[model samples]
Target: MDKKDRFTEVVKTNQGLIFKVATLYTNNLQDKEDLYQEIVFQLWKSFDSFNEQSKLSTWMYRVAMNTAIYNLKSGKKQVNTIPIDLETERFAEVLDKTEEEKIKVLYEKIQMLNLLEKGIILLYLEGKNHQEIASIIGITISNVGTKISRIKDKLKSQIKTT
Candidate 1:
């Protein structure tokens, strides 16, 4: 494939990485779009450095997640300050949550988690193995398991309280 074809394939295969990271990082639609764009930019910028040592999905996850966490840590975005209109708020509140709502709440709860925890949880939720997750995040495999356990428990508690 040409460079453009390869780029398109990468984006198509990994849009979920961008969307999920954006959702966990920001609550508002506009900020989600901004985060998504920032992640896309970062991924494209780093594309040349992806030396095929890891799976494309794993690399995309790493780039998107690191971008979100870095933006959060740099105080470049405040998820809570994003305004929601009354109509939208009511719609969001009243919408009958099917499986999708459950996933949304889970994602929101994951957002409340710390950056590392969020990374671990996101990988776990995506069904990545511990070793792959560790490789993506530069953590040990055992640490990935331990963190995922703790994150799961923390998310359960957060869900209970919410």
Candidate 2:
């Protein structure tokens, strides 16, 4: 396939992954949609540089995370507190209602995290390994482990106190 075709295929297969990253950074539908579009634009612009050394999903995660981080830092999109009842139909299909509710609660707590911790936990939730998280976030593997442990403990404490 040509570059355009390849890009389309990659995006089609990984759209959920992109949306997950977007949702982690955004609180409302509008901002989620905007972040998704920005991520796609960045992916398309950077497609030529993707050398297949890493999985496409991994690269997409890196790009999406970076874009979201930049957007957060620039104040282009302030993170809002996501309500538990907020509809997330597009990305909620994988889970049944109960699981979805649990996820919503988890996300609510996740929103309390700092930017780096948010990225780390999101990647961990996505099942990315320590090495992959480290590479994507530009940190060492040991640091990834350390951060994930701390973040998990923090989340656990938050859940207990709530």
Candidate 3:
């Protein structure tokens, strides 16, 4: 397949990561869409650099997380006044189940975290090992463990209050 085909395939397969990460990061629909698009764009830009060194999903998650966080931190103005679209509303509904309810709550709680905490928790929830999480976030493995521990406690307390 050509680069365009490969890029399309990757984006199609990994769209969930973009959606989930965007949902966790932003409350507004426009912001979520913007973040998702930015991530896809970044992934395409970095597609040529992807050697078979690691799993594609893992690399995609790292790129998506980094792009979304960087865009959020950049303080660029986004038009977020409109209500969320039907798809995001449906997504919120689907994610709000009893088992997933806690995860949804945790995602809400994640908004209170600094970017580092958010990145760590996102990777951990995505089932990335500590070493992989550390690699993605450019932190030591021990730091990833420590941060995840604290994040869990913080989420527990935060959830209890709501």
Best by TM-score: 2
**Ranking 2 against 3 by lDDT, winner:** 2
lDDT per residue (tens digit) for residues 76-119 in model 2 = 54455333322477557768999988888888998999999998
Would you list the C-alpha lDDT of every candidate in the order shown? 0.76, 0.83, 0.79
- For candidate 1, which ten residues in a row score worst on lDDT? 79-88
Off by over 4 Å in 1: 73-96, 159-162
Which is the better candidate, 1 or 2, if ranked by TM-score?
2
The superposed Cα distance between candidate 3 and the true structure at residue 7, in angstroms, equals 1.0
What are the per-model C-alpha RMSD values against the true structure? 5.3, 4.9, 3.5
lDDT head-to-head 1 vs 3, winner: 3
TM-score (C-alpha) between model 2 and the true structure: 0.85
Q: For model 1, what is the alpha-carbon lDDT of residue 56?
A: 85
lDDT score at residue 88, model 3, on the 0-100 scale: 54
lDDT of 3 at 130: 94
Q: Scored by Cα lDDT, where does model 3 land?
A: 0.79
Off by over 4 Å in 3: 73-86, 92-104, 159-162
TM-score of each: 0.78, 0.85, 0.81
lDDT tens digits, residue span 79-157, model 1: 4443433233544665666955776766667668887887787788889999889898899999887888887788678
Give the count of colliding residue pairs in each prediction. 0, 0, 0
